[model samples]
Target: MTRLRSAAAALALSAAAVLPIAAPAHAESRAEAQVNAFFGQYRDAVLGQNPNQDPTDVREEFMTSELNTELDQWAADHDADPVFRAQNVPSGWSVAYGGSGAGHSTVILTEYWAGGGHTDVWYQVRLDTLRIDGLEDAPQ
Candidate 1:
């Protein structure tokens, strides 16, 4: 009887371990969503990571707002025409976020086709305002 009880208890414990549990969502409407949307748009614009891997050969573009804004300012400063700028500027990227806290986050991205290797992007988000204070490759 003792051995039978021990076996039954073990089985019960194992079953509990495999049982699924409900959990709340995180990053659904935050930085994480932003990252996902960026990549999804990228895949749509170019046949990304498919038969035509790294499709920047056709055109260049950035999926992040921060980078886009910076590029626009640079173009304005240089008096660069839009068509010429698009053909020469860096584009096509993938990102991996490091850690996120109350107001700060880190994202590492592949910068191969963008003219170099990989880069780590840092971000400051104001949760209260639900807005990104800033984002850049180097520390701000």
Candidate 2:
């Protein structure tokens, strides 16, 4: 009986130690959550995993109208996807809170490409509405 109890206690302790490390990390802020969700859906659409959804529609839903217009111009001028800042879609991404000031917050999105490269896109979000208003390549 003593050995059985000791074994059960050891198993319980091991499980407890692993639980936190095994769990997925969550966004730390509302702005981070919004950007993470947007990129999740946008990536799916762009990859054709969600055939019924359009990536442009996803942009319109998350981005302000003015920013969307600016992105369109940027795309035309650069001949690339302004949001990803690349012609190809990334395989995975992660979002983190950058900072907040002047009624706006920044979310840094790091996109990982299949070809062994990554890009950090900084998104400016309106704090009041929690809407993404601007995005640009990471400052040099």
Clash number for every model?
0, 0
Off by over 4 Å in 1: 10-27, 42-69, 73-118, 123-133, 138-140
Question: How do all models score by TM-score?
Answer: 0.37, 0.79
How many pairs of residues collide in model 2?
Answer: 0
Q: For residue 5, what is the lDDT in candidate 2?
A: 100
| Residue runs of model 2 more than 4 Å from their true location after superposition | 1-27
TM-score of 1: 0.37
List model 1 lDDT by residue over 28-122, tens digit each.
44554454444454454443444543433222333335545664675587675221233343355555666777665544444334556444444
- Top candidate on lDDT is 2
- Highest TM-score: give the candidate number: 2
Per-model root-mean-square deviation over C-alphas:
8.7, 4.4
What is the alpha-carbon lDDT for the whole of candidate 1? 0.49
